[model samples]
Target: MAATIIDVARRAGLSTATVSRALRGLPNVSESARARVQQAAEELSYTVSPIASQLSSGRTGAVGVVLPFVNRWFFGQVVSGIDSVLRANDMDLLLYNLGDTRVHERFFERMPVRRRVDALIVLTLPLSEDETRALSSLAVPVAVLGEPTPPFWNVRIDNSVAAATAVRHLVNLGHRRIGLITGAAHDPRRFATPILRRDAYRTALEAAGIRYDPRLEAMGHFGIEEGAAAMAQLLTLPEPPTAVFAESDEMAFGALRTLRRMRLRCPEDVSVIGFDDHETAHLMDLTTIAQPVVEQGALLARLVLKALAGSHEEPSDTVLPTRLVVRGTTGVARRDAAPGVPPSPGAATDNGTGARGARSPVP
Candidate 1:
């Protein structure tokens, strides 16, 4: 008979499970046990039967992609990057959505993905202690794309630094009355990035001798509509901001839309800045921080692939860098010696960040 896992186990003097694990190069087996298994398999002229192996293995020859909201710009682009890598690797991707708690809980808690995918790539949502705890016990390997995941492979960026850098760009341009338009997420006690970026905004403003003005800030969700909503609210105030730094390109684009609708020009009426140098940013000529999103995807994908190959060592955490890409969206603060404009003040605070969320199923 052609070689089978049972035959290999019988010849190696080990249990079928041990022999199976040895063939996959999984670590728990001792070196001596592996050697014996290898030798026996050779003697039996054993070659794994693909069909039989599939019947015995739980893996479905697929990778799980966990993401938050797929409709947003950054998440969508990052997904595109991951898809490219997975396609080249000859693997299929399974997608899941976690835009809300119900959707997130139903899938993650039920653990339907168990045995369905060989590995998982988490994009954004910061798993709570309970969620993180459950994920750690999963049977399959995991690779995180956005934030640094413990006891697993991951890649990310420094959010505090990125926000500081973007804010600093405006500070350098002499924008004292620079306003930060974040979203519902800005209230860290309630959401994620809002607080981090707000802190970075504060730090940069304080360094530039400005007082933090709560009145100058507005909040919205992670969408273009929210950006427009925030901008419209900011416009009617007695003292409109001279410059604005949005946390994402979607918001920035929304700001752009509001500005256009109001017949106000960017950098001229008010300078606008955004995060994530997405393709739309280039099209809109938005000045912003360019994160290595696609490259991050490649790195995250490689980590998942390594786990699939049973070569995963200790868990790894990687942090990538960001750069400023100047475009038409931002310019010198309106206070330029022009005939008609007033001066402005600033605010201050310290802060943080994370990256490594991926495409496929994560947010």
Candidate 2:
């Protein structure tokens, strides 16, 4: 039969309560008592019940991760990173995917994770005032991934700077007319990332002395199909842009597909750039703004652990750095190509500019 705490207490010649306290490394237990309990536990092969330990410690031994989409590549990577840290620390992860509007509302209304987790990690979801209050009422340590919410730990990259770097790369390549494929324009959730990137795109264009043309911008909603449709729409415009910046690699893949279907060569006809440097970005040969997706997730987990340990430090807002990774997808604009007209079929590709190994400085 498996040995229990009672067996350990008998072997150590101590009361059951003292054995429990010593085995848990709790205070009020002398060093000698702790040593005796440890030896007794080893000799008797006794183990403490995880449930009982949690009950005595007043902690759930699990962390809750809340995000919009679980299936998306970005979120998947982040979760993996978080799980790595938590698993190493002997803790559990409870995921809450609030992808659907009803589910999101229900989660906030029910407050299911209130006492079930030791801490919470929110990923890139824009919370309303009521929702924020609801999360605060949970009384758990909270960390946010994308935006800085006061009184909560935050870990994120500079979206505005990253987006501007992508646009500036194309402008430096002598592309006067640039297009933007973004997910923020019509999103009801009002996610902070897309909005910041969109505003940066406009600001970058103005800085480059290019006119802000609404017709050059299309809403992809950060999906492959939506990106394909948005690309087609941009191609149909009277004066199509020679370069396009997609807010995500998935969307950029769709744009590349659209270019193939229309028999237009990348860079030679339409230079395309994307963000996130996703796993498949290199396979697609996409130029993008690369952020440390896994690192950000791991940092957030560390911050939560610190908060859980009763760290008195002020809530930290950590903004990680992003870099421009130039690949084959972006190139110099065709000098001979006129506005409102596509370049000639025989036009040579401008591979010298924005080629692989070329990197734009992130400001």
Cα TM-score per model: 0.76, 0.90
Model 1's alpha-carbon lDDT is 0.76
Cα lDDT tens digits for candidate 2, 131-166: 988988988899999888877899999999999999
Clashing pairs in 2: none
Question: How far in Å is the alpha carbon of 3 misplaced in model 1?
Answer: 21
What are the lDDT figures for the candidates, one per model?
0.76, 0.88
Off by over 4 Å in 2: 10-14, 29-40, 344-363
Candidate 1: misplaced stretches above 4 Å? 1-53, 186-191, 336-363
